[model samples]
Target: MKRSIALLALLLWLSTVALVHAQTLPSVKPEQVGLSSERLGRLVSMLRNDSEKGQIPGAILLVARQGKIALFESVGVLDPKSKAPMTKDAIFRIYSMSKPITSVAIMTLVEDGKIALGDPVAKYIPQVAEMQVGVEKPGADGKPTLELVAPRRPMSLQDLLRHTSGLTYGIFGNTLVKKQYLDAKLFVGDPTNAEFVDRLVKLPLASQPGTMWDYSHSTDVLGRIVEIVTNKSLYEFEKERILDPLGMKDTAFDVTDKAKQARIAEPFPNDVTIGTDTTFFDPRVPQRWQSGGGGMVGTVMDYARFCQMLLNGGTLDGKRILGPKTVAYMTADHLDGSVAPGPLYLPGVGFGFGLGFAVRREAGVANVQGSTGEFNWGGAGGTFFWVDPKEDLFVVYAMQSPKQRVYYRPVLKNMIYSAVVKPNGK
Candidate 1:
């Protein structure tokens, strides 16, 4: 009788632990969340078909509505080379998606009165004050020449958050300033955040701060600021304040643990190039540069919690990450008519950049289907997510095909909005 009682108690304890482990976002039927089950099935089938055709190595997509998961599906293998089946908890290199998290980190400092958005970036990193803009001018021989000019105004923290800080990604363009960035070889030796910023500040700005929307190393600089202000590494501060409290156990700068390394998703060997010449980094290898712009890996469910927090007005499961008003402020459009959309106009038509997201400004101007208030951003490694406040919905799509990201992002967006059979809480 004593042995049986002990066995029962052990089993009960195990079951209780399992329940606690499973207590992420609750799962519910598609109908319960006002999504069409058939439509969601079609979306999954399309992804599966794409995988089977070898168009992609694998993918994991999560769609949640009304604060409940309506669909969570994994298709294809975790790695094309290993042929390991993809699992729901498979990790992905979320690249630029790291920006939003870093942006949130900066906002947390703002909330605590440690930083202000209007504060000049030079206030944190003094070298930034010496930075100058590069303008192309016609030389005596009629060839284009580079001229360095002082910025009209200093770059503010808000400028970094909205990507209007006159920074440019070298890989994206071949202008004089961009060429300087490439010549610097910023990522050559796996420089630490401080070293990276020190090298970056020496480069000429692509445009005057607050005058252009150019996607660049602004977030990476923000990561250095986090380190400076908090007296902790970017990952350390983020993990403690944001990831730990939000139950984002699998999100980090890299997959350092031997156990979780197998779960890291990979792209098809042939489809690895991001731009014309650049390739995606290996997430399995740990690095000191915790790139705030593009260096974080996470599972779909882990990101789902992050998105849920955004959709829930910056709180999840009673843990308030940021106040509702702050979330709204972050999501609202920061660009005005004066800010020029540079050569790489990433936000596209009908969208304006918010703090760290491309917020839809209208219902019809954008080529893709989405609500006006929806804010979103994506990774270079084919991971994308969006939060539609109007529909009370959010979707996270994870994959590893960098070359196919542009094509698939819109296709996935159109398909997801199509799955919403009922809208506006109907």
Candidate 2:
């Protein structure tokens, strides 16, 4: 009788503990996630006051947890000139955010044995075989000019993904290769694959393959490489492989539908002096360069679906876009000690360039409250996403700021961490 009573008491304690855990999940309605409703009103008021002072023209913010879209908020006007209010479903030009999706497309091909990480880029695009490295010199005008020289090593598909192939962005920072990339008009206009290939061959690399980390148009080059290997245009390959399977209905390189254009948010600059100039670039035009680096528009909820898919190990609902192992490979660190000679833009961060996104190995610099295994990537405009497996959490923030300063990672992460409970209901 004494032993029976002891066993029953132990079982009761375990049940009580589980019940408490369910109650302490930190889950709440969307409005409750931020400061209270009164505080949120204050936040909106502050945002408006700042906008009038030319701090920012408009903004949209959302926070979701465990598939529950608990908060969706917008402030200021979509267009300062037109005085249009931002909407929850506003579309934005998601620049480098497009890289992660394109990287997914490439990995799909990898899963099918269509390509390998170690494959030479020249194997698919012959013009790349003749590529050279740029050496700085002065022209007759005494201004800087680039001369073509042989590369120390060949650039591989893996090098392109990791930004170690010495291919520098012409606009990233002023350098000899930057001038050359601009002079060659590498990505300025629409061009056939053959034309793009010819221009890329003539351009010189900035460094030897696998030597350094520089954000360049390498993903854009990957777009062309995909066409060569798959024998299909970049859009066609992405559509059949990723978009259709994942049900990302609103995402595309160009906006052809009038209705869709109506919902596309105008890009805003973080600097009030510039604001948003609507008279600038038009997204409706079909261009020759489908930049894998920074070329695509997506809605807020649609992008959330993409994040959720990644959170679930490359599957959404019953559809699987990639193998779980592929997802792991893509998010793992590929950096070597010799690469990235400069201080990292993000402090206490070790680089992990999988197919596209950067994974955070060091937590202190990321200043993120998520798991050490978390990885994320954002756009030029104020768009961001981070996934934490330890917390089973995912967060995305979308804004169309031109200056690229609004979507802060640290503060936003702090807010999310405040709501995350320890596994045992601590």
**Which candidate's lDDT is highest?**
1
| Residue pairs with backbone atoms closer than 3 Å in model 2 (clashes) | 30-70, 190-288, 268-401, 268-402, 269-402, 270-403, 347-365
Candidate 2 wrongly placed segments (more than 4 Å): 1-54, 137-148, 268-280, 341-351, 367-369, 404-407, 421-426
Q: What is residue 71's positional error in candidate 2, in angstroms?
A: 2.3
Tens digits of per-residue lDDT for model 1, 1-426: 999999999999998885565447989999998888998898899999999999888999999999899999999999999999999999899999999999999999999899999999999999999999999999999989999999999999999999999988898888999999988899989999999999999999999999999999999999999999999999999998889888898999988899999998988888887764678788788999899999999999999999999998989877889999999999999999999988898989999999999999999989999999899999999999999999999999999998788999899889888888876577
True-vs-predicted CA distance for residue 340, candidate 2, Å = 2.8
lDDT per residue for candidate 2 within 49-103, as digits (tens), equals: 7667766666665555664555566777676667788776677777788888888
